[model samples]
Target: MLKRLLCLILLCAALPAAAWDNRGHRLTGELAHDRLQASDPAAVQAIVAIMARHPDKARFDRNLAGLTGEARTRRLFGLMARWPDDVRDTPADRPDWHYALKIVHGWTALDWYTAGKAEAQWAANLATARNAAAPPAQRAVALCWLLHIGGDMHQPLHRGHRLDGSWLKSDRAGTIAWVRRGPGLPPMELHQLWDKVFDPTGVDGGDENGDVTRLHAAFAPRAAAMVPDGGFVQWRDESEILARDSAYTGPALRATKAPAEAPPMTAAYMTMLRTIAERRVIAAGVRMGAALQGLR
Candidate 1:
């Protein structure tokens, strides 16, 4: 029993700290695609053209074999959102670019550099996506990052991580903080719980049509109202606040060293988590659309 528990702990610890899974990223991208069609038809065409020049366009073509017309383009855009994650372990892999894990310390400006390079990467990628002097293929990659990082920025855990008390250092954005979702269920990482809060089954409700349409219809109005005027740094700061106030609440923060002894998330906590996850997904979509609309 001791050996099994230790193995499980090591397995959980090694799980990748991805901000949002494939479903979340795809939903955000699809919603943004729909928004662009409704608000900026020309930009939609421009973006599609740009994405055509992506270095992995052939792979995209193979995956989108039967898809054509608007369906093909929309799905293509969604694939771009997942490209950054898909390229992991390859030459293009940039693990640190996915998050900006700001330590919740009272450190001075001199120590701010200790945080991940996500914010700086965001600025650089946005500039690349907008720079006409750059190659079309390069802009396509940057555009993909914009779609992806926008979703990451809204994930509370991706912005700030706990370091005090039970965590002598950090939870690595909850990737190592094991917890139970319910009685008799196996222990799972806290970050994975939040990553799948919107789609707990990990299959998007097994709906053939997917969750983008349903989520967009349900949260479009709220997302529109909440969309920022524009400021990536400000958006990240909002997530940091949510991490401290919402994500680190209840039994989650009371993590102990034992995986088998991990606490179960309460019904109320799950309710709150789903609500925040829904808002973040829709907001990320609308914001991505708004950012793309600026393309000349």
Candidate 2:
């Protein structure tokens, strides 16, 4: 049992970093799917048809096996949101497209930023998705990327990477700022901590459907207020503000300067992180829904 558990942790650590874990990504997709269904059922139909033309349609089919109708559609949308992370290091992977790192040092925003092509890639994919003349399979791939990247942009860490005095280099969205959840716990990347905040006990091990339903209901009241009225640029900027003001506060900032070992995150800090993370996830879902509704 001990050996098996160790292996699981190692395997998890080997996985590439993403804006959110599978459960959070699924929730974002599910919410967007629901929004699209309510406002434009025809758009949902169109999206489903386009997804059927994906080059990896067989892979999708395998995952959707034994499921049908609404359940299948909802799960497929969630899969769409997670597909990019699933295909990392493949020819289709665009690692840089996952983040637009507005660098910071301490409390000050730096003038220089990394060449994160999230904005450009998102626009390109959107154009392809909307272009009637584009090949069906190509458009299908574009649509998948659109779903994934839309969620990526709303993750605050994906929007900024800090430059700590200790390193004088970007933390690469907190990938290196290892932190402990409690005393004697194994060190985990700060990025990983935030990524799994929504599904801490493991998405598969928890009540994912219930959590999704709960999150959607909780945020539904704020849906009208959370829409990205100013567009993707505005969404990116909002995440940057949160990353600076919320994510990089106090204990998280201190972890950056720790010499070697991962520092412990305060209990109060963890509580606050959870609140910010939940809000960000809902905002991402709402904005993604709006983007899909705009699809021609």
Candidate 3:
């Protein structure tokens, strides 16, 4: 009886720490790497140089967080889906639930809400580049960052409200709760499943033994195939199609159904989350390219 009780306690303790690790930051790095690989060699070099100069991983993550559109949604969905059951139940109010779903999920909603602002920003950038006769390289870099960040902002999890332990709060924000073992699952669980639908290998990174360049190079063809010679508008259209067909459709359908029990956050879910993070990174790359093209 003591052994069983100890095991239970151990499992319970392990839950929160596991939850803290599931965020878009991990995936964004891989996505950025993938985008650079798919890009023109010169562009890739330029981005790398810029990244090296910046040195602030948090800034990079924050920049990625600002992205919008389907790319953001898809990535967030991936992260949420793979979030550990224990972490998913962790509330935003709890400091230990550091990666609690609040900021990430809230950012997702905010992405939708502020999409127009993003569009306007793109337009303004384009105008500035055109009128000021900015160098193509400068214009391109700006455009790339814009697209990347916009996609980040669009992720639903990023837009989630921080539930400060308010009982009346409609949105759970960053709160941990018990996974009810029953036929009807909670909204949090539903949200989690939707986040993990993408394949992790598709995005890139995660393997210490893996060659990022090779991995990114391998996926370049698919990302490039999605791009037309003309540029960003085509990329935007492709992203929209992905959003409508893949990101929104799968989750919307699954969310309608109830789970028998709150699913445990498993390795499989982590894998799935990793995959979505990679894709979001890829989507940001594509969007960045598109934003630049619009400037031209």
Candidate 4:
């Protein structure tokens, strides 16, 4: 019995990590785009150079592996909610570039509630790291990952609630839930609405051509409009409210009568989801650029 229990404990421990693997690909793609648009040209150049250095897909995967959970999640979400300060003072010692990368990566994952505190800490750490300075190559890699993660954190679904139907549990009101059931099923509450049911239909699928890019272009403007113009506290409050109201509607919660599972796929829903995702991706890029610029 003890051995069986230990095995069960180990299996439970591995679940989060396993879940992370499924989502990490999209997250990494988002961060890479964010880093390329950093306000600091030197920083952008530095990041790109680093990415060029290790063309190995495995290294990129490994870097992403370190960016899951609450702390990092909070930081990434915060970047979207507000801008960074430009005040600068060189520090005496530089921390590990990898460490700094992780810090920034995590910071980008922040949401509205944790944004204020996390932003402050990120500023301090960034200053210290800047003072310790890396060659253009390493800095570039760090910056890119930071930007990518920041974008990932902002997708309404990414900053979901914990208890009332968020990613961790299967209440089906966030990205995790939507992803589990591709399309065509009854929507999983607000998340499905946001992810796949909010928009008009007929825009769902495309040939393998440049459909993704075209989709990104379509929603960029709306997303840019959604970027909040306020302080971290304000953003956090807004995020909290959004999570409570939209993602966890009372009517939706009461409707659940069985164990959770993915919904069926439908062309109409897929089209709606694509539109929503396009808007989110564009907004993420614009907001990340604004945050890096330290603009209000």
Q: Each prediction's TM-score against the native?
A: 0.86, 0.85, 0.36, 0.45
Candidate 2 structure quality by residue, lDDT tens digits, 192-259: 77888876463236876677667657765666465456678988888888888878887787664353
RMSD of 4: 12.7
How much is 113 displaced in model 2, in angstroms? 2.3
Give the range of the ten consecutive residues with the poorest summed lDDT in model 4: 97-106
The 0-to-1 C-alpha lDDT of every candidate, in the order given, reads: 0.75, 0.74, 0.35, 0.34
Q: For model 4, state the Cα shift of residue 6 in Å.
A: 21
Model 2 stretches astray by more than 4 angstroms: 1-17, 107-109, 202-228, 256-260, 294-296
Q: Pairing residues by index, what is the TM-score of model 1?
A: 0.86
Q: In each prediction, how many residue pairs overlap at the backbone (N, C-alpha, C within less than 3 A)?
A: 0, 0, 47, 30
Per-residue lDDT tens digits of candidate 1, residues 1-296? 43233323322333244777777787788778877877888888888888889998887888679987988877877788878988889898887788877645222121242345678888899999988788999999999998999888889988876654355445767888888776677777888888876565643356523665566567656655664456787778888888878998887876556789888888988888888888777878888888888675
* lDDT top scorer: 1
Question: Judged by lDDT relative to the true structure, which candidate is superior, 3 or 4?
Answer: 3
Instruction: For model 3, give the 10-residue run with minimal summed lDDT.
Output: 97-106
Q: After best superposition, candidate 3 residue 144: deviation in angstroms? A: 7.2
Compared with the true structure, what per-residue lDDT tens digits does model 4 show for residues 1-296? 43233223322321110011112223323333443343444544433344444323344444335565432332232221211111112241111211101101112232222211233443443343243255444433334434433433343443443332122223322323332234444444334345333223322333311332344345434543554355433433343454444434433333332326444434554454445445445544554555444211
- Cα deviation at 212, candidate 2, in Å, is 4.8
What is the clash tally of candidate 4? 30
Model 2 TM: 0.85
